[model samples]
Target: MQKALVSIAVAASLGLGATAAQAAILDDVKAKGYVQCGVTGGVAGFSAPDSSNVWTGIEVDYCRALAAAIFNDADAVRFTSLTSQERFTALSAGEVDVLSRTTTWTMSRDTQLGISFVGTMFYDGQGFMVREEDGIESALDLSGAAICIESGTTTELNAADYFATNGMEFNTVVFVDQDEVVKAYEDGRCDVYTTDSSALASERSKFADPDAHIILPEIISKEPLGPSVRSGDTQWFNIARWTYFALLEAEELGVSSANVDEQLGSDNPAIKRLLGVEGEFGAPLGLDNAWAYQIIKLVGNYAETYERNVGPDTPIGLERGLNALWSDGGIQYAPPIR
Candidate 1:
């Protein structure tokens, strides 16, 4: 009978393609998503708080968007900042509900850390940053340069790998956290600063003289950053995963918070299902059809969030290269929200 209900639901709702399929509102996933990051001060576009004690960033908005999805209220989340060394342990120990700390999803973290990734929210790559006066035009030229990086991160390993593979030797000016890494680099303790290309740009944006530095053009390692939950909780995983994908699908469907009400009357089948207009698509997941609707209406679709928080017009100003929808030139394709 359960199988029959699910099958009927799938058929009736037209397959909720890339949509989050209204997941079950398990208490476990609910508690899991009530997440907090290590520090809200670093990673300008990913997570940071502003002068008014209000938090805002890509990762911050993601949490807000997710909270809206789960509880229908974006502000229903509480946060505690963790450091790089403490984030994973905190998640596993149930210290945070979700880890949206701009963390890279790697095999070790996935299989070994007892955590699971829902999907890739941001596709990035490791790169180097140097002062404009350094005359280091390419990563290939950074022979024997001291590079600043945060420990307890894949960035350290990736930096070593890139330098070794390129037959270049480099010195690592390691720090305990991202803030330390950035400060050490800014103080000229290291000849170069390295992290994801996006992070290099983000860090550079905060510099006293942002134009004094330049991020090299070369990308060293792929960094697929996203949200993570404890491994054993399937319900939480489903909810978080679908909630993220729903953002992408909403963007693809032209659903924006500003226009969501107008779209409630849309005749498009896909739009109807997404906005809770026609089918009970969210029923099986123990959610009302408005799960995605609330997310879209409150936090907006993927592009909207990205453009708002990290787009080219923003301080972080990331280009929608790989993050663009598959329909566009990028690989950011979400499953159909049937």
Candidate 2:
């Protein structure tokens, strides 16, 4: 069924438009009074369920941000936990409204999977992790080592590419889920673990002895992770994409949750336009003018979500790095709300 959907979508892109193309998912979500969001099942600081089965993470905040934009309520959202292999399938099958997991945005996935990426929520790179006791200080020493990785992710290709480029031979232990990959590495089934660098930090933070594992300094491939929605619905696409951009713009303009009410009386044109006090930007997308305002009011800004979930203070302990505001020596730029 997934393959058929992909084929039909590819055909449509090639001028073989299908008559059964889907209507706006945005309408369906509104009619349901909530947004169903797909999230990673176990990646710490990105998406994970607590003991009560309640989800909270940076990506979870993204889903909440969307809910706030639409419903003016952050809690009016549902989370569907998914593995790397199942995330895209669940999204394309309409099992979820939006995929806010740590899914990388790539050309093949965007074009061949009958899905559209909203925007990059996190900038990451592939790296390796190994036990500190292994006497291995760098990825270069893992030539003959067995590496554990999750299948159905860009990490697979990246691992292969990096190994081949360096003329190194290594055994690959692939798993259907990240949990198994982490477990396999923990159980000594593989000599090394590889994934997005931040993920390596996240996974290691969960270990019984985090200090025993060291992430190698080599960052191999770019992984721009973000949310995605099924294609054939331009309105839904716009809503998801702009929801992310709104958060970035909010951070860039210093319009945070605390000062948003105060900024309403200010004279800054960018702040006024972003909060919908001066423009009709939301109307064209079937949203009210206060869409962005509601998002920040309920879910806060991008930096707030990041700091709370995976910042240097969190157990995952990730710095903003490349995810900082564009004006602050980072690449996290967004289109103006105007």
Candidate 3:
């Protein structure tokens, strides 16, 4: 079903001729000397700028990994901060080459939108956060409270569905941007702020008193947040998807940026293939044989990116509950390089 929708979009993209199917986006990026990545305006642990104006987060690292694969330099990427309502339009209109703004993969988006999701980078779920003083122990306690939510996101629908299912009634205060939602919630415009649990954690970290707010225990919906590209370029799609897989594969093979050089000398077939030591993996993707190597050398592996950005020690303090490796009893599994 998904393939059919992608085919329709891909066919539309190829309306010119066979020559147009070569994916000029990659060449365009190379000519510009940087990958244009769209990111959220100010979600701390996902994609936000520091005081130095440098962007850092799990999503930022994904874009950096793509730059490392192509330019052999992780910093060869730039970011455009986008609001939820403007993200897809920016990507579809050639304003950005890739969208790494913590977007959820949904059926309507997959089939209706002219974009294709690469793969899951961060697994999240819809959740609510309330002031601790409210004494709201559960979602059931918010029967008549007003909720602050961001527009043009799945959060609004999820909240509606959850409330209706639980026979609870609530008022909604919507904002076009996430920052507005957060500000309104902070200013006490609403009694509850609802969104992805990870985002709630990220937003709460920026509050004057982080401990004054608490996230409820209910997870309302599955949100597999990942990067995406405009449809119709198979080569670019493969490049983005494989770059993400390279991160996961590197982690699974015990490879990190600190030790990737040593792993290049490894005799294991899997390691050799992953490091582009014995396989012609990069030729198909129009990249160098050392493409994956450069990614690890510059951006590190999935575990490194996660731990450095939003892991247990970070301000977000997200644990590897479901984002861990499959071998470690989590669902973060990747296919073999071969």
Candidate 4:
């Protein structure tokens, strides 16, 4: 009798452990039938709506990739536009499953905010933008200029630190929304606009005369912008992290939405593992074996998404300098899927 009781207790404990290990995010999102993705109100090339109200950009692609991996449908995502101040709070309150806005991954944000930054989707730098006629070729030239910046964002702190470090004085015109900041800049209420270089490119393209503005050559600080999830959910964090890495690995392996099925049978060992040809990688993440295949098939790889949204050919016209693949002398590299 004693032996049977001990055996029963052990089996119950093991079952409980197994149940606890299941992904809460996966279950919640599956039950709801859609993922709530937080995005900026309107930051072109990162997250913006088209004429038909379809949200499309690098960040939007990340959210869709998550939905595709879980639900097998990229459209199983609902985008929630958030401001800088409301982003963290909204994410913390369970209002959004993931925050994929142009948020900087800093130490304070990672530690103090009770959120986990999954991985960098875009390698960016802080910079200044001014009217072409202002002759401000560098950030140093904006010593006493009035700068337009978004409040409650890393841009404000970065701007302060950059100016202070260089012993320059400047005035800041703060706004809560990107649209207001852009409008103020357009109205000449601010002599310059300071933000991430990618955002500068994005905002400039929205101007009536995009040719009238020029982003300065100075890049002040590194900004690794990516997805974020509420802390305490390790399963959710892993899903977001591995999803991003899968996108990068797909790009490295030349797997796009167009050719994902073909590449699933590739000779490369890493590609084989990533596409779930002969590995148990996705099992550990609480996903199916073809999880990566779903992501790449539905959302394409990092390069494809970047080119379509913000690359040199797009309105943003950003060159893939540091954002290129590692083999191409860029910093974008992913770990082996195996």
Best candidate (score: lDDT)? 3
lDDT of each: 0.82, 0.90, 0.92, 0.89
Flag regions of model 2 displaced more than 4 Å. Answer: 1-23
Worst 10 residues of 3 by lDDT: 14-23
Q: Return the lDDT, model 1, position 73.
A: 82
Poorly placed runs, candidate 3 (over 4 Å): 1-19
By lDDT, the better pick of 2 and 3 is 3
Q: How far off is residue 132 in model 2, in Å? A: 0.3
TM-score of 4: 0.92
Best by TM-score: 3
Residues 1-94 of candidate 2 have per-residue lDDT tens digits of 9999999889879755733443468778889999999998878899999899888899999999999988899999998888888888899999
Error of 2 at 234 (Å): 1.1
Candidate 3 structure quality by residue, lDDT tens digits, 32-101: 9999999999798889999999999999999999999999999999999999999999998889999999
lDDT of 1: 0.82
Model 4 residue 177 lDDT? 89
Q: Please give each candidate's TM-score.
A: 0.89, 0.93, 0.95, 0.92
